[model samples]
Target chain A: MSATCHPSDELLVAYGAGSLDEAASLLVATHLALCPRCRAEVGRIEAMGGAVIETLPPSDLGADALASVLARLDQLPGAPMPRSPVVAAPGLPSPLRDYLPASLEALPWKRLAAGIEQAILLQARGIRARLLRIGAGIVVPEHGHGGMELTMVLQGGFTDSGTGYARGDVAMADQQVVHSPAADGGETCLCLAVTHGPLKLTGLVGRLVNPFLDL
Target chain B: MPDKRLAVEPGPGAERFSDLLSAVAQYGDRQAFALLFQYYAPRLKTYMRKLGAEDAVAEELAQEAMLAVWRKAASFDPGRANAGTWIFAIARNLRIDMLRKEKRPEIDFDDPELVPDPAPRADEVMATQQSESRVRAAMSGLSAEQTEVVTLSFYEDTPHAEIAARLKIPLGTVKSRLRLAMKRIRSELGDDQP
Candidate 1:
């Protein structure tokens, strides 16, 4: 099935141009693996970018640029040797498989609240990526973001502010957005969330616990 | 609607450059790489500067990107993308990696997820001497405003807010313009298929 919800076109274009930060790029790549339509769109966008580069006026490199590159080439690996294709695990997409634990059960889940668990994936240079597991019917604290936050649903679904996001859907929120996301009924929700900055808890209780949340 | 626009051809030197790249991949020919570098490095530096890089950083990254091209030549496929497209992608990827300020583990281009689709859709292939020409024709169709936002977005280090400020437009407007431009370009490329 096609993804009903996708990252905004601007985000995808940023991705195609290779301008997106690492955390955001991972979220988009994971979604692209599950959504063929988006994959095709990205392909076209990249092609368009290559086209623009062709028409741009050429700029001359420094006189030694080619010499420097050629000199460095000898120290670096030469041509890529042909190798067997990597076999991906059953459920995880090839890109995501690299970051995740061996299996769902192998995750090092840490308790953040009742019915809520989190596993920090990668944190570097002011950006953070994590996996969150919220039991069915659990409500995450209502909060706003300091910067951009991208949440990609990996399993089951979640609902926030009257919108339902199923597997492979992305929920993009920023400082201007404030809402409590609740896991949909039945299976627990597994989501990969990446944030550029810390979140600001909204409600009074949330604000009180905010100091401890460190999210 | 198949518009009556004729395809724009890539410059005369692209095929020879492609052959040079193939030589580098097959035999690690330094001379072939030097020829390819002479043609692309300057252009890649210009491309990087347009994306807001300073001259020194742009020069460094252009060299680094070409080095990557030398190392990854075996992964390049002429059937999937032209030499211009392949070199452009290498530069663009390097730009993004530099902006992130953290060198990620070396990404393998041969990964299935990373490879461009091996076959182009029949209608999307332009009736031109070079595949890159069709893409250029499609880009030429974008409105000036749309093209402005698109070009600015390629500056990997510049945030959307900075782009909006530079263009004297609201941030949301920049995003909306980019959205519209991308859709039009996609259609122009004959990628409107469902």
Candidate 2:
């Protein structure tokens, strides 16, 4: 972030409030992972959300809400889908990874770079999310997004433009602009990326590979 | 207006999110997982709304997040962080993913001149603004530039990035100002402890 950033207090608020889209969510998380300053700001806003909740007037439940929940319990064991293998991060901005059906931390990850590796944990809706590892001094190509791409840095450091990112950071791209990310040396940059569509390569080779990468 | 969106009494089975997460992980019970979903879904919806996402989009994200919870139920560990903190981290990361990177400028990390002073300021305006009125007043204390970052982050629902493009101040500044404001507020609150 060069004096400015994509996530602001309001966005953090909305993020705390759950108004952001899935595509954008990844980007902010990537940024937050690296920038501790934003992380603190987000924490404050979340507190404000609690304050707002406290200030709100109370309303009664639907009488059978508890019973309904309890009744629904029995059917849960037979849920239509298999237990989804969600990756559980150790820190902030966590999502459904809370109920992951398996131990993702133990999975075998393939190296993409020195510190960058990826474990393709799950895929659905033409979107595939995998864990990425980026070691220090590593620079990814400066490229634009395709349709939607979600990335979360689990460890180490990476920076794009003027903003530096660290563990727990997430970034989302949506064919809006181009960026080249490089990891801070000596630190391992572990990330989780979800590609909603094929990636559109930039630069000359990007153009040539665009046909073959099929991403 | 915020109140209108939430359910009262938090419905039923009001247990801490951490509790439910622990139960599922240690016990391998699906019911524990269900309790966690019922506990968080509506609040998660409200959170999505605050992010300025459409209800459907928010709902979908929330569902996806929840589904992840279903799948990841076995890994909940209570020692590292509480359940709310952990889930919040996940949801927060998920939201961060949605923001797109605009035109990324080349960064010269070698030049110390380019980086904002990394010093953490303790007495920024946001800290002084403890009450609602104080908060509004504190906004006046910031330069219009700082105020914009604050407003966009706290109100506009735009991610930190769009704020950079809209203001052209650079993403680092946006993060720094926010950090300063939050630090100030924490100090202000801390001063009252005695």
TM-score of chain B of each: 0.72, 0.48
Q: Total clashing residue pairs per candidate? A: 0, 102
Over the stretch B149-183, how does candidate 2's per-residue lDDT look in tens digits? 65455334445667777778787777787667655
Q: State how far residue B8 of model 1 sits from its true place (Å).
A: 18
Tell me the alpha-carbon RMSD of every candidate.
6.1, 12.4
Please give the lDDT score at residue A201 for candidate 2: 62
Candidate 2, residues A118-202: lDDT per residue as tens digits? 6665554466656666667887755677566666565566787767765544555677868778888886676667776666668
lDDT of 2: 0.51
Q: DockQ for each candidate?
A: 0.36, 0.07
In order, what lDDT does every prediction score? 0.74, 0.51
For candidate 2, the per-residue lDDT at B23 reads 59
TM-score of 2: 0.42
Candidate 1 docks at the CAPRI level of acceptable
